[model samples]
Target: MRRGLKISLVTLTGAALTLSASACGGKKAETGGGGDDKKTLKVGLAFDIGGRGDQSFNDSAAAGLDRVKKDLNIQTEEISAKPDEPDADKESRLRLLATKGYNPIIGVGFAYTNSINKVAKAFPNTKFLVVDADQCKVEGTNVLGACFSEEQGSFLVGAAAALKSKTGTIGFIGGVNVPLIHKFQAGYEAGAKAAKPGIKVLPAKYLTEPPNFDGFKNPALGTEAAKGQLDKNADVIYHAAGGAGIGVINTVGAAKKLAIGVDSDQYNLPAVAPVKEQILTSMVKRVDLSVFDFVESVSKGTFQAGTKKYDLSNDGVGYATSGGKVDDIKAKLDQFKADIVSGKIKVPTK
Candidate 1:
């Protein structure tokens, strides 16, 4: 029934888009200027790490673009960043999009901070949105920074692991040893101990450090990390690693252990169909929401520059229960979510 409801909603959304387009002379048009000026809106996306098919972060962003194209009848261009690509390369990618008259080009990950910063200055009239990058540092610019509270969602999943662990030990695999990933680690550790005092949370491991972002794309590294943790008697494991997380899920499923997914509802992904049962839950970061919201704002000509944040109260971050594997713990997770939103519980980002 839930799946049917979701499909119905999507159908309605598409119908609304079609209706709107028909009202505008058979196709929706961008109207940035006043008085009878009609132009087609073109948006561009620069994906992070594993790109669109990784079934994770990049896929989430792609979902947003798909919605914008269908609902708003907008044109979009998407490009993927190379593994360990330099800032200059990223800048060039954004620049290419802007030169082609794509307004409001977006960068999908924090790694694009330098690139977006550089490119935004070059294209003053073009609006830019950088996901997961610090907006405070870019305070006086024509760019918008869209940030999320990943720690809050990670905490919920971490607590779930503690309640469900048979061995009373769990593990975490991070994509990089940066502060962003650390926010995930800190919240997981805190929530595990909060749920079950004295429970053993295994040490966290990072596949690589900054300037070497292969960790986000290397499944081999993720599999290796998960194996090490599983060998240490961890019954459940969670990963904030991007594309590499695919390997983690595969490894855990092959071993018949539980694994937590990140960024998206990974259990629903076709790439993980064979091991769907292994995903206990996922820390859904809502990148799709952020991307879609920005596109909507641009379309309405209310596009604002500066920072925008997504958090627990805004449905920005939370855990997924797609496989019904976490049904027994649903009530407990709900309480945690309310507590975080109501300020009774403060999930750490450090």
Candidate 2:
């Protein structure tokens, strides 16, 4: 379900030879236009730390690029960010794509907020999209922010966890202690409390603090965090960690406990095949839809600059029931979703 008001696309000028970097790699799709057409509409994506193989956040964004390649038949370039890389590297990545004539370049995570702002200003004609960041909301800028109501989705999954918890105790694992991930923590706690007033939600465990984003990519950290929670008798655990959440799912599955995923549907991901049955549900954040819609807008000459919010009202975020584990509780979850959408329930973001 695409949602947005279409407007005319802005024309961009200039193009340069492609460049490569040691910290990041590029994957170019040859589906769209070729040659030196100034209006080729090439899409560029700068992925977060975990990149495409995480089967999580980055992969969700990749799904959108894949759709653009297939449906729009447009050329696209993808670049992955290295863990803990300096902010300067992000700017360089975006600039490289812009120089290579990739219009409507997308910075996939909040980490690229500053980089996108700086680079978008330099390439005034090139349109830019930054995901998960609201700071890119500068007036008259070429950058458009694609932000999500992650708390709304997390709240639904938290309620699911509480309803399914046999021990009346659930846990949450976050990749980093940043405010973005905090939204997941806050909503999860709130929903769990709302669903089961006496349910015990262990203190949210963070794999790492600020600056050490390895928590988003390190499976070992996720495994360790899940172990601690399970040792405390947590029968169900939900993680907002990126690639690391894979470890949490695997560990919880092996222990015969339930695990919840984030971003994409983990139960359907081949990467998590061994423990798919253990995944109760996932907070499905529609990064894929957002990315695809933005690129489609650019290609169709209807690109708009500013922030677009994806939330329950628009079906932008929700929980996945891929394993039939949450089927019995779907009605309750939908009711909660309705309440949230109707303003009867306010899920906290902090």
Worst 10 residues of 2 by lDDT: 1-10
- Candidate 1: tens digits of C-alpha lDDT, residues 76-119: 76777676768888887787677766776889998888788888
Per-residue C-alpha lDDT of model 2 across residues 145-263, encoded as one tens digit per residue? 99899999999999999999999999999999998999999999999998999999999999999889989988899999999999999999999999888889999999999999999
Stretches of candidate 2 off by over 4 Å are: 1-38, 134-140
Top of the candidates by TM-score: 1
Candidate 1 CA-lDDT value: 0.81
RMSD of 2: 8.3
True lDDT of residue 294, candidate 2 = 86
Clashing pairs in 1: none
